[model samples]
Target: MRSSTLRRHLGLKHEFQYRQWCKANDFTSMIPKDVKIRKNAAEAAAASQTIIDDHAVPLPRKERVIPYSDELFQQAAIEWLIETDQPISALEHPRFREMIGIAACATNGVKIPNCKATRQSIIALFKKNLYDLWTQFAVSNFCCYMVLSAY
Candidate 1:
């Protein structure tokens, strides 16, 4: 097969695997349809005993172990600041760094950018959604308080 064809195949395989991983982790998204021929060929190759293990189809070479998505960062920020009810100012706290670490762990040990730029980016993202998230946190807390008081 031409190198271009192989590269395309590798991309497809990675896409399929990534979809599977996300689904297995209960992340909701529409999984793209796998290319039927590629799927079948891969299955057949796995089933067949090739003559040499060394020449076997190589595992996909992922450029990054953890695929960084904007949504992931947003979700993590929501989880940290809203779900856990941390103050917006707490973004400067070490707890925020721990939350970022948790996000990295959730992606199966993907390398998280821990530099100044990454911190700035996350801070910006959190700032962008601050008002809405704060409203949500207040409402949730009030509801919980009302429920407890009634009991």
Candidate 2:
């Protein structure tokens, strides 16, 4: 097979491995030096293998594992709870925990905050948002005052 055809096949059949190889080395230099085809052996192998319909075979699902941060997750959860008007106690509910566990797919399951922890997170978030809003308001008012004084 031509070098281009072989590269295309590798890219399609072993995409992840091909990408990793490309990242580690120049792809052009990585191509095999020898390209040979035994017609008899190829024909025998092809005859022995049964052809299957593509529609009959289900494609494998790829799962990407992303690093999890407890602090970020807790902050996001607290914000979502507040936005949805749910009680802090909801974080400790078995059903809610189960749902999070299923969604997170962590080996040990995600650690959800208890009522007290949830309340604390909520308070922290509120204080941060309030400070941000106050700063914006103060800056805008100062700018307005400066413009008025200049006039």
Best by TM-score: 2
Per-residue lDDT over 1-151 for candidate 2, one digit per residue giving the tens place of the 0 to 100 score? 5878876677567767876777788553333321223455678899998877765777696555546799988988999999999999999999999998797776744565799999999999999999999999999999999999999
Residue-by-residue lDDT tens digits, candidate 1, 83-114: 77878878778976787667665645555576
Q: Provide the lDDT at 56 for model 2.
A: 79
Error of 1 at 51 (Å): 29
Model 2 regions more than 4 Å off: 1-105
TM-score (all chains, Cα) for each model: 0.22, 0.33
Scored by lDDT, model 2 comes in at: 0.77
Please list the residue runs of candidate 1 whose C-alpha ends up more than 4 Å from where it truly belongs after superposition.
1-66, 98-107, 110-151
Q: Candidate 1 versus the native: TM-score?
A: 0.22
**Each model's lDDT:** 0.72, 0.77
